[model samples]
Target: MRSVFVTGTDTGVGKTVVAGGLAGGLASMGYSVGVMKPVATGGILINGEITSSDLLFLQAAIGNTALDEKALSMPYCLKTPAAPAIA
Candidate 1:
């Protein structure tokens, strides 16, 4: 039951990429990986619906676990390109 926490020095620092890569690698090694973003700043528009690309990548990496998006991501998402507090 080993776990790892991935954090970033600042926003847009490729945390998502690193996390997804780790999860994908772990899953390939026969580990049941779970990903949690907790908080995110940017909003990705998909098929006329606003979603988080980070979460989507995580789901793809982990083979789409039963966890819902709300449980994986934060509630508030900012539309601007800046930080959530500023956007």
Candidate 2:
């Protein structure tokens, strides 16, 4: 199986866009694509739970909800709009 690790120069630098696009492209080529952000910051509180928009995009691209969005993508969520360590 092939894998990819996508990182950015800094936060909010279109990392999600690039990652999602790559997953979509791979899926279209008949490959099983999985995306994991590992850590996210600046999560919005919805219904008393933290969530990030990037994870949502990744879920949509993969077309599966069995993969835990929080566990698979956002293991750590920071409230402030900054780095995880800083926020």
Candidate 3:
């Protein structure tokens, strides 16, 4: 199996777009794709659970809920909207 890691020098970059696009494209080509945000800040609480918008977006791009495992997709979600180092 192959894996791709996307990162940016700062926030507000096209990391999500690029990563999602890649995942979507691969899935469209009938390849098994898995997306993991690993760590995310600025998460919102929904039903007393921390939700990561990035993970949701990736899930949508993949066109499936197979990546719905919050514990695995977003292992470290912080409520504060700041960098992990600070949050």
Candidate 4:
């Protein structure tokens, strides 16, 4: 099992895009991928669920495969766009 982590000083950077690209690349090479976020503050309401678009893109890049048990757990959800510490 291999893993990569991407972090930055601010939001709206290329974290999601880069992660998705890496996942896509790995998936193209026939490796299964799992995407996760420990805490995400803001997200869109999709199908009655608050979902992070960043995560959505990452998951899509990895394809619609069944995620493992840990990845199936819910994320820390917040309603505002502010930092998690204050949200």
Candidate 5:
């Protein structure tokens, strides 16, 4: 199994876009792909739950319905837009 980790020095970069693209591309090629955010700063309310858009994008990219397992993908999802420590 291969893994890809995307990181950026700051927020609002193309990390999510690039990661999602890679995951989507790999899945299209018939590869089994799993995506994780681990920690997220900002979130939006989805069905009464605060959800990370980046996680949702990654989940959609891999064509999986694992949103119910958000704890696995994004263990730390903060509603605040500040840094993880401050948020």
Candidate 6:
């Protein structure tokens, strides 16, 4: 099994685009792909549940929704603007 990890030194650096493109491309080639966005900060709070926008975008971009969108995300969520480490 092969895996790819997408990251950046800062936010808004096209990490999602790059990662999603790779996953989508691999899926188009008939490869089974799964995405796990381990950590995400500044998630939107809806109905008292913290959610990651990145995870949602990735799910749609890779055309993967095998599991619930919230299931693929980390258990803990932060609402800070900084990265998970900094926040």
lDDT of each: 0.73, 0.76, 0.86, 0.70, 0.87, 0.74
lDDT of 1 by residue, 1-87 (tens): 788999878778888899999999999999988777766556687656556777788878988834346544546555456774565
Top of the candidates by lDDT = 5
Over 45-74, each residue of candidate 3 has an lDDT whose tens digit, in order, gives 877888888889998898866534778788
**lDDT of residue 4 for candidate 1:** 90
lDDT of 4 at 84: 44
Q: Rank the candidates by lDDT, best first.
A: 5, 3, 2, 6, 1, 4
State the lDDT of candidate 4 residue by residue for 1-87, as single tens digits. Answer: 887887876777877788888889999899977777667778677657676666677777887533332235236656578864577
Best by TM-score: 3
State the displacement of the C-alpha of residue 73, model 2, in Å, after optimal TM-score superposition: 2.6
Worst 10 residues of 1 by lDDT: 65-74
- The C-alpha local distance difference test score for the whole of candidate 3 amounts to 0.86
Off by over 4 Å in 4: 65-74
Span of ten consecutive residues with least summed lDDT in model 4: 65-74
| Candidate 4 lDDT score at position 3 | 76
Task: List per-candidate RMSD values in Å.
Answer: 2.8, 2.2, 1.6, 2.8, 1.5, 2.3
Which wins on lDDT, candidate 2 or candidate 3?
3
Each candidate: how many clashes?
0, 0, 0, 0, 0, 0
Which regions of candidate 3 are displaced past 4 Å? 66-68
**lDDT (Cα, tens digit) per residue for candidate 2, span 1-87:** 777888877776888899898888888798888778777777788667787777878878877554345775678776667874476
lDDT head-to-head 1 vs 6, winner: 6
